[model samples]
Target chain A: MAPALREFCYWMDRYRRVWRGTVVISVANPLLFLAAMGAGLGKLVDANHSGHLTGTPYLDFLAPGLLAAAAMQTGVIEATFPVFQSARSGGNYPAAAATPMRPVDILGGHLLFVAFRVLLSGLLFLAVVVAFGVVGPARALLAAGPVLLTGMAFAAPLMGWAVGVDRQSRLNGLYRFVVMPLYMFSGTFFPISQLPHWLRSVATCTPLYQGVALTRGAGLGGSHPGATAVHVGYLLALTAAGVWAARRSYTRRLNR
Target chain B: MGDESAGAGVLIEAVGLRKVHTPRGGGEATEAVAGIDFRVHRGEAFGFLGPNGAGKSTTMRMVAAVSPVSGGTLRVLGMDPKTHGPAIRARLGSVPQDDTLDTELTVRENLLVYGRYFGLPRAEIRERATQLLDFARLVDKADEQVEALSGGMRRRLTIARSLVNRPDILLLDEPTTGLDPQARHLLWERLFRLKQEGVTLLLTTHYMDEAEQLCDRLVVMDHGRIVAQGTPRGLIAGHCTREVLELRFDDQEAAAGKIRHLGDRQEKLPDRLLVYADDGEDALKAVHRTGVEPLTALVRRSGLEDVFLTLTGRTLVD
Candidate 1:
C-alpha cells in the first residue's frame, strides 16, 4: 500500500510537470467557449424571449451544461492517450511491473491520479462558470461534486478502452465518430428537446448525457430529485462496468 | 579468488521449466523454453549464450517474473514467481533488452522515481541516486533530460537505475549488445565490481568474448533447448580441440578439401578453412606437407564459439 501511494504520488508529480500545456489549454477552451456561445448565442436567446430564458438569463441556462461538458472532456482526454502511452509506448507500466507493486496497484494509482486531475480541472472550469455570473457560489460548490463524478464516469470506461487497445488509430476514430458526436448531441450547448426523438433517445442513454443533466439539475436548480437519481444510477452502472473491464485488461496484459 | 564459501548457497533453482508463446495471429504455439533445468549459485555470474531468436530472452524473462511459464516449475530466491512475484521481484533488478527510461524526466529524477517504485525513502533514494550517478559517470548530466543523453550514457543510467533498489539478483539481457568495445569494457569492469561485492548476476549475450570475460558458467541454447552447459573452459575443453588452425586460400573449397586430410576434425567456412587439433602448429606443418600452399595461415586457442559451432553444426551468427 505504501509503495502504491508512492507510485501514485510520483505519477501525479510527473503529470503535473508534463501537463502544464494541457492545463492551460483546458482552462482557455472553456473560457473561449463561454465567451463565444454564452455571450454570442445568449444574445439571440434573450432577444427571442425578452431578456429571459424560462424566466432565467440565457447565460445561466448554458453555464452549468458547459461546466459538465468541460469536465467530461477533461476527464476523457486525461484518461485516454496518456494512459495508453504509459502502458505501451512509454513502457512506464512495465517499469513499475518490475517493482513490488502489482498490476492492480498500478491501475489504481493511475486512476487516483486521473480522478484528481478531473476534480482539479472541474474546479478550474467551475471558477470560469462563476465568472460568467451563471450561479451563486454555494450552488457552484455544490455542482462540483456531480461534475467531478461525471468526469470519473466518463474516464473509467475510456481508461478501460485505452488498456485493451493496442493501436491509437482506433481510439482516434472513436474520439471523432463517437465522443465528438455524443458531446454535440448531449444537451451541453442546448436542450435535449431540440434534438430529434430517435437521437434524443440515444443521447439520454449516454453517460455524458446523464452527467450533463445531473450537473445542470444541481447547479441551475430546475431538475427534479427522481430524474437526478436515474441519471446517477446510469453513471454508477457505467463506472462499475468500466472498473471491471479495466481490471481484467490490466491483469491479462501484465500477467501475460 | 574471493571468499567462495561465503556465497555458496543456491540462489536460483529451476526444475524442468518451460514457456510457450501463442502467436498473435494464431498458428502453432512456439515453445520458447522446452523443459530446461539449471541452478545458479550465490555470488556467481551466469549467462545464457545463444543467437537471436534462440529463447535466451524468453528464459531470462521467466526468471525475471515478467513472463509466465506455460509448464513445469521454477523458483527464484526459493520463492515461486506465480505466488510470490512481488516479493521475489522486489529483490531482483532487471536491465531489459531495450532502455525503458522515462524520456521526459531528468537523469536524477528518473533514478528517484524508480527508487520510489521500490518504496525507498526520499533521503535514501537521493543518496543512492547520487552514488549511482557517480558510478555511471553521469553526475555531470544529472539534470539533463534522458532523451538528450547518448546511447552509452543512457545504457549506463539504466544500469544505475536497476541498482536503485540495491537488489540481490541482477538480470542483464545483452547488456552490451550494441555498445562499442570501450563502453563494453567499462560495463564489464563495473559488473566485475558488482560480482566482487557478492551480487548474483544473470546475463544473456551472443558475444562469446563477453561470456568468457564475465560468466563463470553458461548454458548454450538452440531451438529452445539447452545444448550444452558448463564453465567456458570446461565446455571448450570437452567439446572442441584445444587449438585451431586457420588456412585461407583464394578458393575456400580447395583449401577446405585439402585441409580435411591434414587434421582429425575440420570446418569449412566461406572465407577460410579451420583445422581443429590438439596442437595448431603441428597441424599447420602437416597441412604444409600436403603441398597445398594457402594464401595465409594462423593458429589460435579454441574458445566458446568453437564449442557452439561443433555442437550446433552452425556458427552463432550466419
Candidate 2:
C-alpha cells in the first residue's frame, strides 16, 4: 500500500473510538431539517404560493438543498477544528512525522479522512430524505454526487484556512463572520432570486449557493445541462485551488 | 574499549552539520547548530553535555531525521538524513525533551498506537507493548490513562513507546530533566540496562552526574560549538584538577584573594571560592595554617561542571 493510504487507514481506526459524537450530528442534522423545513415550512410555502417555486412542492425542493447544506456544515466543521487540534495541542501530526510517515502523508491522510466523512454524511442525508418520501430513488442517488462535491468545495478551502491559523481563536472568529453568513444567505432556505440585485450576485458567487443550486436543480427540478456543468466546473476549480493552498500551508507549518 | 567500538562501524556520523532557524516575522536567522563533527559507533553510549540553548537538542533532532539539515552532511544508520529520513527514522527511536505521549490513551495504548505508526503488525505491537510496559516499570499503570501518570511515569512511557519498534539506536534529549532525584535514578538505571543490552545509546544532558553515570564518551558544548570532547574522566583529567577545595566566608571577594597561594588555581563564585588542588584536604589544612578562619570549607572530586567552567569560564547552569 502507498504510505499515505496506510496512514489514512490508521486514522480510520483512530476515528472509530471518537465517531460516536460526529455520527449523531451526521444522522440528526438532515432529519431535523426534513421535519422543520420540508414538513412545517413546506406547508406554508405551498399554501401561500399557488404557483411559486416553479410548480414543484416546497418539500421536494427543500430536501436536496438541505441535504447539500448539511453536508457543507459537516465537511467544514471537520476541516476547521480537527485540523487545528491535530496541529496544535493535539500534536498528532508531529508525532506521525517523527515516525516513518512524511509530511505529505500526514496532510494527505487527514484530507482523505475528511473526504470520507463528507461522503458518509451526504449518504446519510440522502437516505433520510428518500425515506421521508421527499424525492424518488433516482434523483436522491443523483443528488448524492453534487451534494458531496459541494461539501468538498467548502471543506478543502476551510482546511487551507485552518492550517494557516496561528491563534486558536481565529478559527472561531472565521466561523462567526464568514461561515455563518455563507450558510444563511447561500440560498439554502430560499432562492437567491428573492434577494436584492447586488446581494443576489454576492450569493451566487459563494460556493454554498452553487452547492444548493446544484443539488436542488438535480433532485427536484432537472437542471439545464449548461448550468450543471458550470457549477461542477466551479466546484472542481475551488477544490483544486484549496488542495494547492493546503499543501503549501501544511509544508510551511510542519516542515519547519 | 570505546575505540574498539568505533572500529566496529559507526551508526551515526555527522560532518560539519548545521541548523538555522529563522524567527517569525522575517527576523534574523538564529543558527541553532553551527557546524560540528562527531560520530556514534555501534553499541556505544555517546552524550552531548551542555547548558540550555547550547544546541544539543538541535543536533539531536537532525540525527533523528525530523528537522531538516540546513548544511553539511548527516548519516544515521548509514543513510543520509536529508534524503532518506523515513528509512533512517524507521530504524531509530527518539525521546524528545518533551514527552509528547498520547495523553488520551492508556499507557499500553500509547505504545501500541506509536508502533502502528511505524507499520508494525498488530500481534507484534501487542507483544512488544507488554514487555515495554514492564521495562518502563509501568506494568501496574499499563491500562491507566497517560494523563494520570506523574511526570516521571510519563517520561518513562514516552521512552517505552519509542522502544516499541525495538529500534537499533535510541536518541534521548535530556531524558531526566524535571524529574525528581529518585525518578532520575530509576530512568538512569533503565537506560543503563539498555546499554548493557548492547543498544547504541545517544543522549544529551545538563546534569554533570547524569553524563558521568550514563555516557561512555561525551562532548561539552558552548555557544553552538563543541568546546571539549572525551570520556567524562578524560575531560576532567584534561581540563580540571583532580580535586577541589571549596571555601565560603562572609566576604567571598576578600577570601578569594587570601586563598590564592593555597591551591594551584582558583575560581570565584557568588557565595564561595573554589580552589583547584591536587589533594583537597592538604589545601584545606593549608587554608587553616594561613589564619583566614573561613566560615565554611569542604573538599570534593572534580566533575564535568569543573571541566565546563575551566573551558568556557562560565557556570553550566547559569
Candidate 3:
C-alpha cells in the first residue's frame, strides 16, 4: 500500500512535467468557448428575449452546460489514448508489474490521476464561470461537486473501453462513433427539453445527460435534490462498473 | 547436516512446470514451457541455454513471478508465486528481454520510482538512485530522459533499476543479446562484480560463450524441453571430445567422401566440416595424410555449442 502510494506520487509528479502544456491548452479552451458562444451569441439572445421566464442571460444559462462539456472533454481525452499508450506502447504497466504493485494499484492510480486532473480542470472552468458573472462565488464552489461527478462518469467507461482496445484503430473508431455522438446529443449546449421526445428519453438515460442536469441545476440556484441524487447514484454505479471492467481487462492482458 | 536436503540451499525450485499459450489465430495451443524441473542454490549463477522460441523467456517469467504457472509447483525463496506474488517480487530483481524503462522520466527518476515501488523510503531512494547512476556510469545523463540515451546506456540503466531494492535473486533474460563486443564485455564485467557480491544471478542466452563465462551451471533447452543440463565444463567433457578441427571445402563432393575416415565423431555443415577428436592437431595431420586439400583448417576447444548440437542433433544457429 505504501509502495503504491509512492508510485502514485511519482506518476503524478511525472504527469506534472508532461502536462504543463496540456494544462495551459485545456484552460484556454473553455475560455475561448465561453467568449465565442457565451458572449457572442449570448448578447443576441439577451437582445431578443426580454421577459421570458425560461430565458436567463445567455451566458448564465450556457455557463453550467459549458462546464459539464469541459469536464466530459477533459475526461474522455485523458482517459483514452494516454491510458492505451501506457498499457501497450509505453510499457508503463509492464514496468509497474515488475515491481511489487498489483494490477489494482496501477488501475486505481490512473483513475486517481484522471480524477485529480478533472478536478483541477473543473476548478479552472468554474473560475471562468465566476468571471463571466454567470454564478456567484458560493454557487461556483458548489458546482465542483457535479462537474467532478460528470467527469468521473465519462472517464470510467472510457477507461474501460481504452483497456479493452489492444489496437489504436479500435479506439479511434470508438471515439468517432460513440463518444462524438454522446457529446453532441447529451444536452451540453442546449436543454434536452428542446430535443424530440424519444431523443430526450435517450439523453435522459445517458450518464452525461444526468451529469449536465445535476450540474446546471446546482449552478443556476435551482433545487431538484431528488433528481440530483439519482444522477449522482447513476454516476457512482457507472464508475464501479467501469472500474470492474477495466480491472478485468488489465489482468487478462497482463497475466500471461 | 541435520537433514540431507536442508543444506542444499535451493533458492529456486520448480516441479513439472508447464505453460501453454493460446495462439492468436485460433490454431493449436503452443506450449512455451513443457514440464521441466530444476533448482538453483544460493550464490550460484544459473543459465538457460536455448535457441529462440525454446521456452527460456517463458520459464524466466514464471520464475520472476510475472507470468502465472499453468500447471506445476514453483517456488522462489520458499514462497508460492501464485499466492505470495508481491512478497516474492519484492525480493527479486528482473531484467526482462526488452528494456522496459519509463522513457518519459530521467535516468535518476527511473531508479527512484522503481525503488519507491519496493516501498523504499524517500531518503533511501534518493541515496540509492545516486549510487545506481554511478554504477551504471550514467551520472552525466542522470537528468536526461531515457529515450535520449543509447541502447547500451538504456540497458545499463535497466540493470541499475533492478538493483534498486537490492534483491536477493536477480534474473536477467538475454542480458547481452544484441550488444557489440565492447558493450557485451562491459556488461559481463558488471555482472561478474554482482556475483562477487553474493547475489544469486539467473540468466538465459543464445551466446554459448556468455554461458561459459557467467554460468556456474546451465541447462540446454530445445522445443520447450530440457535437452541437457550440467556445468559448462562438465557438459562439454561429457558430450563432446576435447578439441575440434574445422575444415572448409570448395568442392562439396570431394571433401565429403574423402574426410569420412578422419575422426570417430564428425559433423557436416553447409560450407564446412568439423572433426571431433581428443587431439585436434593429430586429427588435422591425419586428414592431411589423406591428401585432402582443404581450403581452411583451424583447431579449437569444444564448448557448450558442441553439447547443444550433440544433444539436439542440430546446430544452435538456424
Q: Fraction of the real A/B interface contacts present in each candidate?
A: 0.71, 0.50, 0.74
Better of 2 and 3 by DockQ: 3
Question: Across residues B212-278, which tens digit of lDDT does each residue of candidate 3 receive?
Answer: 9999999999988999899999999999999989989888678779879877688888878888999
User: In candidate 1, what are the lDDT values of residues B1-318, reduced to their tens digit?
Assistant: 112322457778878888888965679988888889999988899999988888898888888887788888887887778887888888899898888899888999999999988887889999999999999999999999998998888889989999999999999999997888888998999999999999999999999999999999999998888999999999999999999998889877766676666766888777778889999999989888888888999999998988998998788877
Which ranges in model 3 have alpha carbons more than 4 Å from their true place?
A: A44-53, B1-7, B23-27, B251-254, B285-293
TM-score, candidate 3, is: 0.93
Tell me the TM-score for chain B of model 1.
0.95
> What overall lDDT, based on C-alpha atoms, would model 2 receive against the true structure?
0.84
Please state the CAPRI-style docking class of candidate 3: medium
Writing each residue's lDDT as its tens digit, candidate 3 over A1-256 gives: 4555764676686887867887787678878988998899778878888453277787887788778878887888878987787777337777788788887777788888888889989998888788878888898999898888888888887887786577888877877887777777777766677789988899999877888778888898776788878988998898888888888767766667
Q: Which stretches of candidate 1 lie over 4 Å from their true place?
A: A49-58, B1-8, B23-27, B247-250, B270-272, B281-298
The reply for model 2, stretches above 4 Å from the true place, is A50-52, A55-59, B1-8, B260-262, B286-295
- lDDT of candidate 2 at residue B125, scale 0 to 100: 90
Chain B TM-score for each model?
0.95, 0.96, 0.95
Clash pairs, model 3 backbone: none
